[model samples]
Target: MSSPPEQHSGQGKTSDRASSGKMAPNATNAVSFFNSTAFDTRVNALINEWHVPGLSLTLVHQQELHSKAFGFATLEPPRNCTPDTLFDIASASKSTTAGAVALLVDDEENYPHVQWDTTMSKLLPDDFVMAGDSYTNNVTVEDVLSHRSGLPSHDDFYFSKRSSHPDDPRTVTRNLRNLPISVPIRTKEQYNNSLYTVASYLVEKLSNKSFEEFLHERIWKPLGMSSTNLQPDKTREVGLGDRMSKPYIWKEESRRFQVLEYEQTPEAQGAGSVWTSSKDYALWVKAIMNKEAPINDEIYKGLTRPRIFSNPEDDDLDPFCSWQGYAAGLESYFYRGHQIIQHDGLISGFSSVHFFFPEFKVGGVFLGNSENAGTVGSGILVKEIIDEILEIPESDRTDWNARQHKQNDEYEESKKESQEKLRKELSANDDGLAEPLKLPLDVYVGEYWNIGYKEMVVQIKDERLYIDASDRTMAFALDLEHISNNTYFLGTIYDMLADGEEVDKIKVEFRFDANNRPVRMGIDQEASLDGQLILYDRVEESSGQGQQKVVVR
Candidate 1:
C-alpha cells in the first residue's frame, strides 16, 4: 500500500520542493539521500549509454527532490527535457483508473460484480460474449486490470482493421465488445484488451459520467492538475498540448530517435490512452503518496494488486507480461527488502514510466517524448536511481544489459519466424493455400512507381522478385498470383499472401496498364503510412510529373 503523505512544517527545506511536490525532499539535504555525491553522474551515464533522447526524473525521499533532466527532446530543434516536459505515459494509465476506482469505492457503494465474480457479460456490451464459449462469461473488472482475462492479445478479426459501426465511436473497448474470446475466462493469462476495454465502461457505469468528463471534474480538477487531460483541442489548447515533448522512435540503423506523429485519440476512459507531463504527473505521484487527501489506502492497494499469475507466454507485450511480478495495474518487482510498484505507458510515438517504492517512500517518475527512452530501459534507470538514492546494492538493481539482451533475442526470433511465414505465403495460389506467383521472372522486373511513394524497382535476382523502395529493400519468392501483369498483393505487415483469396491483404495496386505498360498512379485512402500512424490520404503522393509542360489538348 502507498504511504500517507506527511505534513510539511516548512522546516528550512528547499522552496522548490513545496511548489513541485509537497512530498519532494529538500535539495539542500541531498546528502540525506544515499551516496548523494555520485548520484547525478550515474544517472547521466545511463541515459548516454542507452541512446535515450530526453528524460525527466523526480525522486522524492523524505519530502525532498532529487530530480534531473537529460539530453534533447528533439535533436535538430535542440529541445531539452525540462522540469515541465510532458510525455505520453502509455499503459502506466492502468493504475490511474485503479486508483480512481479505489477512491470512488471509498465514498460510493461497491460496484456490482466488480471483482472477479462479475463476468464480461455484466460489464461489456451484450455482443462481446463469444458465440460458443462459456469460460469468457466471467471476466471481472479486477481481472481486466490484472490481465488475467483469458483473451488473446490480438484477434485476426481485429487485425489492424477498424470497424465503422455507428453505434459507438470506434474504440478498443467497443472492439472487445464485438470480438470473439480467444481463451476461456480466468483459465490462462493473456493480456486482454477486452478487460481494460470493459474497465472504461465500468468507470462510466460507476462514476455516473463519461470517463473523460468524470476524470476532468472529479480527479483532475480536485488535484489542481492544470495540464493533464485526455483530448487536446489545439484551438483551446493550453497546457494540454503546449510545452509537450515531441514523441520520437529510435531508428536502430540511424542510431537516434526519429520524431513521429502522436495518433491515439482515446474515446474510451482507461487502457493507457491519457496524456500528461512530468510537471503535472509529479502532482499525481504526490497524490498517490498522500493517502490523507483524496487518494487513500484502499485505492493504493487496488492499483498495486497482482492481477495475474502465470502466462503461457510470459514475455508478451503487456504488463502481467512477466510471471515474476506483474499485476492488474502495477508491475511488482523485488529489490532487496522493497517491492516496487510501477507502471509504464506507450501510445504511438510518446512514452512515459512511473515507479514508486512503498518501502522507503522513495519513488520517481520518468517521462520521455521518445518511445525508445521509456521502455524496459526506463525501468532499469529508475531502479538505478533508487539504488543510488537508498544506497541499495547492485544485486537489488536491474541489469539493463542482460534484460536488453533477452529482449533483443526474443525480438529477433519473432522476426525470423515472421519472415519464414511470409516466404511460404508468396509461393501459394490458394487462400492461405500454397501456390507460387505464376509469372515469369522477367515479367516481374520493372521500376514500379505509384502515386505517392518513391520508385520501387522490381528486379529478378536469385530467381526472386526483389523490391527496392523508400528506405526499405524487400525480396519475395517468385511465387505470387499474376494479377493482370504487374500488380500483386504482398500480404500483411510482414508476409505475402498465399491463398489466392484477397483475405484482406493490402492491395498492392500496380501503376501499370493491362499490357503491363508503366503508369504513375495515385493512392488515396486511410493507411498507416509510417510508425503505425494512420494517415488519411494524409501524405501527398510524390509527383513524377512535376514541371512537365502540360500543352493540354
Candidate 2:
C-alpha cells in the first residue's frame, strides 16, 4: 500500500506535518489545491484495491507543478516509489516518435525532400510492396502515424512473448505484402504496430543513426530528461535500472500480481519501449504544454493537429466532453468547454496516460506499475484532478472512480469464468481417438513454414507430441492432445482471433498421400493473407539439399 503524501509548503522549502486541509499559493505562479489527507487516502486506497505495486503522478496547471509517488517500485525487495523512479511508459512513447518525425520533416538541412505527405514507397525500401489493392501504393507517412493506413490490428504478426527475430523490424515489414488490407487507404482508423515499426526504421534511414541514438541525442539531451532512456541498455549504463519499477502481471490462479521477467525486444521499438520517470516525463509535458523552442513548438503543433476524425468510445465517461478527434500522436476532445488533448498506452505489465489542455495550459502525467493500474487507476486519478483544477460542482463529479473499478471487477470475473469452462471441456475429452494415428508420430515431425510467419517445428519428445511454435510468438511448447483420429487439440491457450474472448482449443490435422505417407499438415490458426488456416508441406530433399515449401490454405 502507498504511504501518506509528504506535503511541502509553498512558501518555504520545508515539509509541513500539519493536517490542515487548505489551499496555499507558492512564491511563483503555482498553487496546491489538493487536501493532503483526502488526496492521500483516496490514491492509497485505489492503489491497494487495484493491486498496483507503485505509481508516479505529475500535474501541471499554469506554472505551478505538483508531483506525488506512492507504494513500492518492486514488491520483492520493497523500494518506495519516488518522483525519479522509472517505469515503462509503453505506447505513450508514440507521441515521442511522432514528434521526432515531425521535427525531421521541419528540418530542411537533413531531410529536405521528406514531408508528411511523401509516399511511403519513396521513403521505404524499393522492394517493400503493399500487396493486393493498388490504392496502397499511395500510402504516405501521415496515413500510418494517424492510424489511417488501412491496416488491421495484427500485432501477432510482429510481436509476442516468443518471437525468435526480436531485433529485426524488417522481418515483419517485409511480410506486410502478404497480409490483406482491411480498409480503403486513409478511409478509416485501424491501430497497427507494423507500420510504426516501419516508421521507426524510416527514422534510422533518414537520420543515419539508430532510433535509440536519435531519441537520445535529439530529444532526451535537449529537454534534460536525465532519468529517461529509450532502451534498457542505456538505462542500465546510467544506473537507472536500480530505480526502475519491475513490470508485473496479474495471475488469476495466484489471485495476485506476479513479476514478469523483462526482455528488451525490438518489436516494441516504434510503438512503445520507452522507460522514464514521472518527473522526467513532466519535463516533456511542460515542454509541449509551454510550446518551447528548438523542437517542441513545431513538433507539438504538428502532432496535436487533427489528422483523423477517430474518437475514443469512452468519451461519455466525461459528460461535459464534446466531440473527440485523433491527431498524429495525440487525441483531442472538448471537455467542460475546453479543448483537451491526451493519449493512453498499455504494455505487458505497465500503463501510462499523458494529456494537456492547450488553451487552459493544464497538463497531467500518470504512470502505474500494474496492468489494471494504468487504465483503471490512472483514469480515475486524472478525472478527479481535472475536476479539482476546474472546480466543478460537487454533484457534477459523478462517481466515476466507483464505476471504473466495477468495470475492472467485471472484466476479471468474466475471464475467470471463461477459463473454468475451457478447463472442464479439455479435461473431459483427453482420450485416444477411435481411428488412431494416421501414419505414426514420426511422419508428422517436420519444419512447417509460412511467408508471413517464418516457421513452426513439430517434434515427438518423451513419448508425446509437442509443437515448437516460436515463430508465431507462442514461446512455450504446445503438447498435442489426441482428440479424434488424425486430429489433435492444443489445449488452454487463448485465441488472438477473438481478442482473448474465446479459449476454443486449436485443432491440428495431418494429411497423408496415396501411399499412406504424410504429405502435409494443417492448423486452425490465422496465418494466411485471406485469414484462413495455415498449411505446411513436407520438406523434400533436392540433390542432398533440404527445402521446405509453404502452402497456404
Candidate 3:
C-alpha cells in the first residue's frame, strides 16, 4: 500500500505550544496539535491498519475550521483524495433534517400549526398513520425525531429489494402503518430510520417543498455548503463525479479493500442520504458550534437537548464517557467532563462522524469511504485529539488503536463461532434421514407477496432453488440451502455487493396447507422485533392459468 499524502487548508498556523502536554484553547494551538508529527503518524498508522481508501478530516476550534485529506480516492486511475472530495455522510443527515424542521417551527407566523409537539397525524393526516391507534393519533415530531415512537428499525422493509414499494417519502411514510411496533411509546429509544423518513415527509408537507429543496434553500445555501446534496448522481450531473470518493469494504479473507457500487437510497432522504465534502461539512459543524445563522439558539438546543438514554447499560463500561443520551437528531455524550454533542453515520461502504464540545467550542469531522472509518478509525482520532486538548498526561491516554484491535478481534471471533454454530444446525436433520427437505423443490417454487414487502419469487436454476426479489436492484439473489423439513438457510451469494463477513444468513421456513401445498414463506426480516417473522403469502395464479404448475429451469 502507498503512504497516504496529506493536504492541509493552512487556515491556522502551527504553534510550538503543541510540544507541551496540553495546548491553550486557541485555533493556532489546535492547528499546531493537528500539524504535529505525532498526530500525523498516529492518523496514518490508523488509516493503514484499517485499510481505509480515503479519509477527510476537519476540525473546529475557536470558531475556525481546518481541514485535510489523505490517501487515494480512486485506486484504478490513481486519483488522490482531496479535502473537496464528496462523500456520503449517511445518518449524519438526520441532524440536518432536524435543523430543517426547527427552521419550520421557528416560522410561527406562516406555520403556526407546526410545532415540535404537534402530532405527526395532524401534520400529514392522510399519510402518517402508525400501527397502533393511540400511536397513530398521538406521536409527535419530537417523538419521531428522538426515536421514542415505539417502532423498531424496520430498515429491511424499505432497503431490501424484495420490497417493490415506491421510492417516495409519502409512500414510505404511509407504509409504516403496516409494520409492527416492538415497544411501548416513550419507553425506549429505538433508532428508526423510517420515522426520520416520516419526519422528512413532514418537512415536505409543512414547507410545501421537497425535502432536498428545503434543505438546500434553508440550510445548505445559507451555510454556503455548495457541495452538499441529497443524491450522488447530482455530483455526476454537476461534473464533479471525479471528486466523489469511491466506496470500499475490507475483505478479511483477501486482506485487501474491495470496491462496491454506490448505494442509491433516494427513499432514505432524511435518514441517511446527504453527501458532501469535508470543506462543506466543516462550515456546518462550525455553524452549530458558534450558533451561526440558520442554526439559532432554539434550533441548537432542540438539536442537542438530551431526551432519552441512547444506551444506559453501556454507560458504566466506557472509561471516557460518563453518560450518553439521544437528542432530537444528534447524540449527547458526557466525555471526560465535557459535553460532546455529535452523531455518526454508516451505510454500505461509507462511514462518517461529526462531533463538537459545547464547553470547549471545539469539534471534529471524519469522513472516510470505507466501513471501518466511523466504527474504528474516527473514534481513535477523535479521542486522541480530545486528550491533547484537555491536557491529559501521555501515560494516562488510552491506547485506542490497541483497544479497537482487541475489540475487533473478539467481534470477528464471535462472528466466526456463530457462523459455525449456524452451519452445524443447518446440517443436522431431526429424523436422521438423507432427504432433508420434506417437499420437492419444484413444489416450493412460487411467488410470495406481502403488503409491506411486496413480492418475492422462488425459482429453480441449475437444479437448485433460489429466491430473488421482483424489483431486484444490484441483482440480489440468495440460494435456498435446505436445512431440514420446511426450513432452509438463506445463503447470500459472495459478490462485490456483499461483504461476506457480515451477510445476514437468516432462515426461511415454508408454511404448508392441509393438502401439503406451500402457502406462505416466513422470513425474519426485522430480527430486532423479537425474532417475529414477516410472512409473505403465496401469490396464486390467475383463474385463466389456474391449476398449472409453474417451473423456472
Highest TM-score scorer: 3
| TM-score of candidate 3 on Cα atoms, chains taken together | 0.89
Q: Each model's C-alpha lDDT?
A: 0.51, 0.66, 0.75
lDDT of 3 by residue, 511-536 (tens): 77888888888776675677588888
Superposed by TM-score, candidate 1 places the C-alpha of residue 492 at a distance from the truth, in angstroms, of 5.4
Ranking by lDDT: 3, 2, 1
Worst 10 residues of 1 by lDDT: 1-10
Residue 17 of candidate 3: its Cα lDDT? 17
Which residue pairs in candidate 3 collide? none
Among all windows of ten consecutive residues in candidate 3, which has the lowest summed lDDT?
A: 10-19
Ranking by TM-score: 3, 2, 1
Candidate RMSDs in Å, in order, are 12.0, 6.3, 4.6
Clashing residue pairs in candidate 2 (N, C-alpha, C atoms within 3 angstroms): none
> In candidate 2, what are the lDDT values of residues 44-132, reduced to their tens digit?
77776777777777776554456777776787767777767888887788888887788788897978888888877778756356766
Best by lDDT: 3
